[model samples]
Target: MKRWMQHIMPPGTKCMCIVAIVVHLDFQSRGIGTALVREGTNQADQDEVLCWVQSSEAGRRCFENEGFEEKERLEVDLDKFARGLEGLEERDAERKWGTHVWKYMVKFPRQVD
Candidate 1:
């Protein structure tokens, strides 16, 4: 867990954390992720608990569409972590390595009518 998570959700807080949501490459961009998030959000709403997720760049839009607000962002340098690895140069020649961003997001439970 990250520091911001602790700040937002202290011990014993009534909250739900979405650890991961993965869609197959062939199934991506087809509302699957959004549906998954919606289901989770609906559950949280029913339970009257806060919902949280750590979203990747690819999943940010989906999470946002599902009503998750960006609370914080973490940027990691992939190149730095990959430095001195065997065949890195060859891999870099084929593709570029740069920063990867993770967005910390939260959605409060919606009030029922």
Candidate 2:
């Protein structure tokens, strides 16, 4: 099945090509997320750029185990951020779904000299 990241990625960043990972929900706790992360890091091993991802709270441990660091925390004020929008737009989609999204960034830091 087609996933959200499959369509929204910044081009050339799929599977083992780019240094990013986008995991699916149903397959999350079964090591699929870790494998995807490993693939990104494997790519980073050969490429100049580092591997990076934004994961949910539940996925933090898998990423941390694979050597990803928490770069920063992200917060969004849906109501404020969604201001000046018409009814039932992308901004209002979250309200309809009744869940706010939070992301913890995971990055394979560049080696320091």
Candidate 3:
């Protein structure tokens, strides 16, 4: 939807990109993640900025539930990516490796500026 956004978003609109959000394993299922993202969107709405994020699977779900839309995707071999992290300690479960897909999600303003 990157193309769509570029086409639809009015001229001179600003965007706020969320790098990431990590909730502890023990704190999963609580609304903290959603709340944090929601606050970002709310502020963006009031300030007329477009909210954006690059989210993982669970993060995509949370943002999507809060009305974020998928705009783009970057699929890669997470194993290779992890392997490139030289000298970094890793666990045995494929060392956080798999078909890693980074999703670009966004929340547009109610009315484009």
Alpha-carbon lDDT, every model? 0.86, 0.57, 0.77
lDDT of 3 by residue, 17-59 (tens): 7877888999988998988888878888888788877788868
Q: Against the true structure, whose TM-score is highest? A: 1
Which digits, one per residue and each the tens of the lDDT, describe model 1 over residues 10-100? Answer: 7787999999999999999888988988998999999999999988988888989988999988899786677565466664654546689
- What's the true lDDT of residue 24 in model 3? 93
Full ranking by lDDT:
1, 3, 2
Kindly give the stretch of ten consecutive residues in candidate 3 with the minimal lDDT sum: 86-95
Would you list the clashing residue pairs of candidate 2? none
Tell me each candidate's TM-score.
Answer: 0.83, 0.49, 0.72
Query: How does residue 78 of candidate 1 score in lDDT?
Result: 82
Q: Pairs clashing in candidate 1? A: none
Candidate with the larger lDDT of 1 and 2: 1
How would you encode candidate 2's per-residue C-alpha lDDT over 1-113 as one tens digit per residue? 13434533456653322334556776667888778777667666656454555666666787787887666555555555554444677755755433355454445435544
- Deviation of model 3 at 76, angstroms: 0.3
Q: Report the lDDT of model 3 for residue 102.
A: 79
